[model samples]
Target: MVLCAGASQPPQSSQTLLAGVGDSSRASLSSGNEGGRYELTPERRALLNTIRYAEGTWKDGEDKGYQIMYGGGQFQDLSRHPERVIVKRYTSAAAGAYQFLPKTWKGVAQELRLSSFEPRHQDQAALHLAERRGALDEIDRQGLTKDAMAKLAPEWASFPTKAGHSAYGQPVKSHQELASFYSSNLRQLRNQLGA
Candidate 1:
């Protein structure tokens, strides 16, 4: 196809044209945005709380992958992990409420800000990653599914599964426990989207 003089079509990546698809998540973000921004809600708060329980405690300067706590303490002895006390099963020595690796954090933190690595900022960064990954929309629509859980699993090790555990943890909560955690909000969240 050729463009007419002074008339042109929008540019699309040749790879996207070949695939017959654009980045639909980003497309949705642009078009279907709720007031054009993400905001905190009960569902999100509950979700973060669940992640915190899994991350265990703060170390270095982050909690779960969040810099939730402030007020300085001694520097880490030698471990790269944020916490002096270590918990394995993670693929990286990540920090914060969402356990972002140093490189990842630096990039995200810079985009978000150079100052104030507080809980709110950390939550925003985590949500930014989650939304970019397409998990937030999936969870909003499906409540929780194997696929949605899988999408979110990479971000939060303890995102639950129906099988009495999560993809990354060693059974932090029981089957009943998991159900209760989701039960209170799942219906409400699903109802919010007519899911």
Candidate 2:
């Protein structure tokens, strides 16, 4: 991985750091409240440059690879909202085609995976299936009580399964759908486990 940094002409009193690779770029600026610019300290500039370079690397593979953006900010009152992050995976093996896998959540690592199949549509279907399986794993790992899972079962039962199939289908359309699917499945799993 190559990393480079540069900047346009800095203002007489302010400094700017430019970080990027090829056609992708990011800029960081340091200025006083009065609008007087200040040069970034070497340490701060290096950090900004590193981040910019990383973003550039991802952008280089635009439409062919995965990109994730994550960060956090505070309200003026200093109460911390959980950090937010989004992951997007893109693939364009077929003409005029692309697949997108996006997930956003707080306090947990966002995961994404991509694969190429002989038929692009099948690949897309598989990706959606994997995402649903992942959600079920999360519910299990979070130690959701059996009662809570049970309470959600009836609604889960009403979800539209794939035509002629007994299991949930690809592309659950909403969080409610995913939750219901997991809840329904959990009830079955709990019984098997005698929980």
Q: What is the TM-score of each candidate against the true structure?
A: 0.51, 0.19
State each model's CA lDDT, in order. 0.42, 0.23
Q: What is the per-residue lDDT of model 2 for residues 43-147, given as tens digits with 9 covering 90 to 100?
A: 222222222222221222122212222211111211221223323231211110111212211111122122221122222232233234342233334532333
Local accuracy of candidate 1 as per-residue lDDT tens digits, 114-141: 3444545555666677676677776566
Stretch of 10 with least lDDT, candidate 1: 1-10
User: Which candidate number maximizes TM-score?
Assistant: 1
Root-mean-square deviation (CA) per prediction: 17.8, 22.7
Q: Tell me how candidate 1 scores on lDDT.
A: 0.42
